[model samples]
Target chain A: MSAARHDGPGTGGDAPTPAPHTDDQPAVPGTGEWRRLSPRTLLVHCGWLGAPLGSLALTALATGGRITAGAWITLAAIAAAFAVVTAAGLVRWARTDFRVTAESLDVRSGLLTRRLRSVPLHRIRTVDLTASPLHRLLGVTVLRAGTAGSGEGSGELSLEALPVVEGERLRGELLARAAAEAVAEDPVLARINWRWLRYAPLTFWVVGGVFVAGGSAYRALHEMGIEPWKLGFVRRAFEEFGNGMLWLTLPAALLAVIALGSVGALVLYVENWWSYRLEWADAGTLRVHRGLLTTRSVTIERARLRGVVLREPLLLRAGGGATVRAVAGGLGNKEENRKRSGLLPPAPRREAVRVAGGTLRTPFPDPEVTGRQIDGDRHLVRHPRAALRRRRTRGLLFAVLPVSALLAGLGAAFTPVLLHAAWIYAVLATPAVLWLARDAYRNLGHQIVGEHLVVRAGTFSRDTLVLRREAVAAWTFTTSPFTRRAGLVTLTAAVAAGEEGYRVPDLAQGAAAGFAATAAPGILDEFLTRPVGHGDRTPST
Target chain B: MSEHAAPLLRPPRHRVDPRARAWWRVQALLTLSGPMLLTALVMAALSVLFFPGALPWLGPLLLVVLVLPAVAYLVVMPRMRYAVHAWELGERAVYAAGGWFWQKRRIAPLSRVQTVDTVRGPIQRRYGLATVTVTTASTAGDIKIAGLSDADAEALSRRIGEVAQDVPGDAA
Candidate 1:
């Protein structure tokens, strides 16, 4: 909680600070002075070692009344294992040391064979700080630095269990040169609006959480050698619930699950995003700091950002809200991609767009251009009718027909009831499929706006991605036999950020090539030529 | 609407080395034959040892189902692939067009090329052929031009590597 800064002695002068002496070990052998992790790390490390040993002891107690010889041997073995693990951890903690120099961050760690890694300050694009609940209690944090152009794990330098103030100072010093012009001025872009809590339950997490909870509960009971269905109260409730009205029970159960799921989702949302703040930090970096129990502070350089994506799922869109995510490089690996990319939680559509524009330092066009002033249709170029036909045929062949055939086959093999039901199901599903195909067609649109190319697509969850034209590194054109017959091709723009490739599927072939050439000129210029009478600057729309 | 009816543009002109055709055929044989031959041999042995009655019909059926596809893969598909696979190094970018059934044409900006690797498998080594892969920062930026003569692969890699170095301000 203290905001005190601990500037390393190396930062003030070239003289190396004397290494701290442990009980028996000598000074670390190196030119640059090596600094050890805070002593608090041992406690954190011991907690990690204690979990499995505690579990084993509990299991032994549950399985037997008194200590047998075998149990005594097991206890001794557990103790030996614990001691070995603790000693190994202590050695590892002792061995790991980091030195911050003017040019690079050097970290040396290993037990027997030492490994040294040096990361240049200029290449460092992100400096992330995280603290778990226990870490917070100990006033220590984990620091990670990511360099551009490095592969996934190799690109990162992590310093685990540093004093919170020291970690903050290190982060600032590493980022100081990169953000030379930046002053410690705070400009709050967005902060947690508790009203946004309503959008939490609107996500698919509710349904997914319910299913996951049910599955885990069943597994837990089964693991304890008890059948879930044999529980007296559960069986009595199910019997009483189902006996009265068979049809109504299904909807009732669904409602109950949904209510429970919504509560779970709300709790998760609060825990993950408590006190969330999006701020413009020193030197053109966007910093997102949030969390309840385990806090995270992620800083992304604005220069690495390629674009922004505005996501509107079905329910959220109906409620006129959307979420925003950044497309940036050197943030983190794939596992952390979602958390690092998230810009804004679901909020009002206008507010989300405003924040996105503020983040990108550009005017992000609202895709929902419904009024008379702007002819949104003129700006967007939709796929040909063939795309719709293709979607309908695909739905029939891949989805509806397969289910109908299976139902009919079962009916033929077993009973006539299913065969009659199949006919009714197919008839009812045909219109729904057609509607989905039509909606999907409506969702497909691509347009070039000023310095950015906006591609809008998706059926249930509509995404409108506004990508900077200069950020696109390559263009790929794909055509299949069926797509070729329909005179269509898919054009994808490859960028170094979110999704990696943004594709516009089933565009008219010539238009796709022309669009590609226009979007990123030099890459596709060799393959494309202007048609006989067409002007060079003619807009496809 | 009129533009939609425009004729398709001619494919990139440059092709891989002429010897690449033979190399591909050998590669196809090595890759497809091993698995198919193993499966056939296993089934034949099982039938002969355990179910002698099935051996008469099973042996020929196995040959037809497994060996025929391997033959087609080793003989027919490689030739079709040779006709389809082509690459061109442009001044600003590198282009690769490949795949017999589902054709893919990819272009990677020369400035974006982060690393260039020339790989030679055992069978490819026998044919004096290699595959050159150009990688960029993006996950989808791996553009592979397979079935190049070893010398050609090395030369191409060197040339691209030099170009990538010469081009400045590639943020990555």
Candidate 2:
């Protein structure tokens, strides 16, 4: 634990480093290792300054051949520079590069400076290959690897102008690696994934549409010499009419919500349609691909998966399956450059387990699976009693909305005009705070699985988080005087990407050992002697 | 889901002190700003709520909550700032934390760290401070601690460079 080195959870076999490419990658004649040269096609495909170049070309064309030769010369120079730079970059990259023999890959690249990047055959978060309309015309794709931060984030590795076959071949190899990796652990390939094909994109579309609609509405109103939104609370006529006409308002409000919601949802749905595909199942990893026009394919290693979270809207609780995802490093949704893939939303819980045989979907972004079998009760799921307290508090807080309305109406009729609804929220807040305190005090049980630390809470919608000490990137604890005296501390443990990290609020002091065990087992805590308050200086690990 | 199963993952045994110049520049504001803010706020509160008569007590309290910490930083940092700490471990992670009074800390696992940047400001040259910013998935709040000597900053960066290349599964 002191200044010790931690070994990687092994992938067995000859999965170490790939053989360095021969001094020269043997060249083939037709469609050789490098694609044929065409700067016209390359400019349109590169994406860096495509638009500007296109605009310049249009301008030159409008001026005819007088400036055409000069334009062509300039264009050729820029294009040549792009090609030379790319070729130089490729040469440098290729010089230091080595690709794994298997699919779910490992491509290490670095020149005078070097790097070795690995994507588990079964732990690939997401792989996206795209093309602008122009790129499509040139038959090239930009392949990006994002360990999903909502599948947001520039790619870790990208191959440009690769023959689709080669790119697709790479993807296939990775998928095969994933499958092979999956087979090594699980005996199930339960791939029944229900893509909320319409949900996200619909949501995106509807929201975008609503924004456009609202802007259009505003423009239309403005053009017509009127203010649309300034209708000022309900119309005076409606306000005066009161409850008698409330029925009419009800329909209108419902209609507005539906119309806006629908248009927004549909617009969103169209923007990103769910192309959720369950590629392969076996091993400890699950391959799930989901996204819209920009598709994201992800692989979650069973060993790295954190835990299972079953979230339910009060209405959807019954036998309905749930949307599930895995927690692994650099894979969540997009937003961070470190993310290698997208967050995999797999099959609903029941079907997923049934499909994957008996594998339960862990809640945490990625759950770690010990190569050894689950020791049953030794890792029984547990919850603290305080979980119920939070639920109860939430239940009581739910009653406040109507109560506030009632208080507002009653106050307006009898109290000072300044005695407003604001006070009611404050009043309600007090109860909520008390409930929170009660909930915090009662929270208890936590379980220690093989190499994972799973914490559970909630009486209804349960939340179970599995932490993999091996994969935990960072850990910190913050304490106030009162909490310190109470022997409690809040831990902020990051799982590579902070987006899907864990914030354990108010755990007993002794749990630091357990938390540490889960965060970085065997790893000694460096901050004990070191005052870890230095703000914002990136660490080198 | 106990993390205990991963055997022992050498818990955060890495640290990388960024450039001293940037570190020092930000250290003053980060450490002193609180007290300065606390002082302004507390004084304002007293003026508004306690009335002018309570200035004596309010003034002392402000000194305790605000000036004391800042003064402590200025006094102790001459030596401690030079004691910049940076450690890089196993792979894919880096950490740097420093400051004399109100201490500063930052941790970035290479996987989540989007960018490794060194920022030099005019104030840094004046006071010998520099900052190394590690962007991550955490949003604007991702600016980790900053403040260090120029050499230490580069060294921390080089160490990160080594570890980023060292992570077992780094082959992309």
Candidate 3:
């Protein structure tokens, strides 16, 4: 890619030189000079017309391939809508113009209001270039520049449908300020490992995605005035399945769903992680380049990197696989942050740890060194026994009781069958609930591992966060009435990057202050009456 | 073990203005009781229109479930908050602790302080009260000192703003 040439100096192609613009005669209503989005943006915007037109065609086909008077009217309305949309898209494209000045990147848009958003070049912490199949076909990509210190809504500057080369150049230009002098010979940290494909089925998407897709399909059919239950083929299929022995059909149906879901998961994995590469581009920017159909290249400034999170979902952990995410600033809002922060796909746990260590620039202690996994659970300080009791109480109170009560209540009001089901459910679920509670309690642990504070918590998706102590902006100690009585408190380490506040839940009351004091010194020192070091580190049994 | 039994964190040195108690009460009454009263009235009217026979028990149930808690909250919360809510600005950090049943103590270092703002709503204006919001780069670390006298709020914000101006970084 020509993007690499931007770092190599002298190999400039169509890259816009950041020569100071000294135009005194600024004529175009506002700003010094502005460049409009690609003309093909109008085409991208008009792509929505295809969906409605396709639906119309399907309706005509379903109705014996003859267009009725209403259908003709609908077609005319669609054409009018298409024309209006095209005009709107054209106006939007014309209005939306962006320019990279010496100090800042400015984007101007809107018809009447003429909104202008300018972000300082220094604060531009990440630049993302994304192109969908349609966008690729049109030879354009969307560029989003995320700025530092701006919270939530107003941090990100986006220019849709910039020509592919221009988008790459813009990305290079935006991040050029932070480009390091040392040209990295081997920038590649990790690449797509085909063996990791076995971990695909372990994701929540495997089973949950099937139901979600089914729901979406059902909703789509319903919206199109088709009742799936009332369909002849669907009903016939269900009848055939029902005709088989109940025991046999139930297992077969489950197997079929599992098979379908596995296929879906494999396909999704391939699409999302095809040719995935994590690299240090120019030694200053960490770049994640991935995706098959919708190619994404997210470049994050090394200075903005707070830490790395090693995520192990239950099934993934069971399968010995984990994922890694960047805890960096200027990844945009919550949704954008999640989408952009993924550093590694579901791969071997050891590989994830290695990637995490590489990303942090500090090698995490290998299992060989400590006879344990990377920043393993053994070294971490476990929460008090009261934490376990609290979890057990919560499980019984919230999960088990509510479900059983609802069933039992319905039985009292309506049927004896529900009453039987309630007891059966309680009997079946009690062990599972207890087991989950135990697992959650076991997962809860925190430790100060040199410069990084490692916190491992959560039951379903165990996230072991390795955060820099220096990145901690503030410290918050919270205690509920119950928690206070139990002699425990939850301490949250607030940072600017990733999730913002990571909680170290249910520490012994006295130990909480000591923990926070140790994790990030000076913040809590003035407030503590006694010296924090003198405080007891309550040993967890 | 003995140290573990002691307070986890000391209460901040300064308490909010005494009038804050009254302000919080009125604030609570307006926010909690007002909507609850309206909901109760609507429920009563619905019961009277649709199921008049159920009004005898439903009226009392609504009062117990909805109205009583709101009334209790309006009366008790202000006093509890007045006792709990305290703040102290150190040279390095802003310390604030508040909440009744679920207490929270927050510390935001001056170095990381991004923006300092003072807000006064219509009700707060009537009560001559203001809230000093010290926003850090982290969304979770925004320290808000509510129920402060207007003058105090202004002075606090100015102090924070001045200190933040001197201590420089991206605050990220």
Candidate of highest TM-score: 3
lDDT of 1 at A434: 87
lDDT of 3: 0.81
Per-model lDDT: 0.76, 0.47, 0.81
Estimate the TM-score for candidate 1: 0.85
lDDT by residue (tens digit), candidate 2, A422-473? 4667586667756654543333335455556565443233344555545555
Clashes per model (N, Cα, C within 3 A): 0, 144, 0
> Candidate 1 lDDT, tens digit per residue, A343-411?
888888888998988887767865542212232424567778788898898877887898889899999
- Angstrom error of the Cα, residue A153, model 1: value is 1.1
Chain A TM-score values, per prediction? 0.85, 0.53, 0.89
lDDT by residue for model 3 over A1-541, one digit each (tens)?
Answer: 1123123343355433222223322111212346778888889987878877887777777767877787788889998998899989888877887776767788899999999898988788888889988898898989888888647867888899787776766676666666455643566889999999999999856667788889999987766556889989999999988887989999888888888899999998999999899988866788898999999888888878989999999999899999999998888877888998999999999999999998988876322112122334237776788988999899888888999999999999999999999999999888888998898888887777778888888888888888898999999989888998999999898888878888888988877887788778878777775645454422211
Per-model RMSD to reference:
7.0, 13.2, 5.9
| Per-candidate TM-score against the hidden true structure | 0.85, 0.52, 0.89
TM-score per model (chain B)? 0.80, 0.46, 0.82
Overall local distance difference test of candidate 1: 0.76
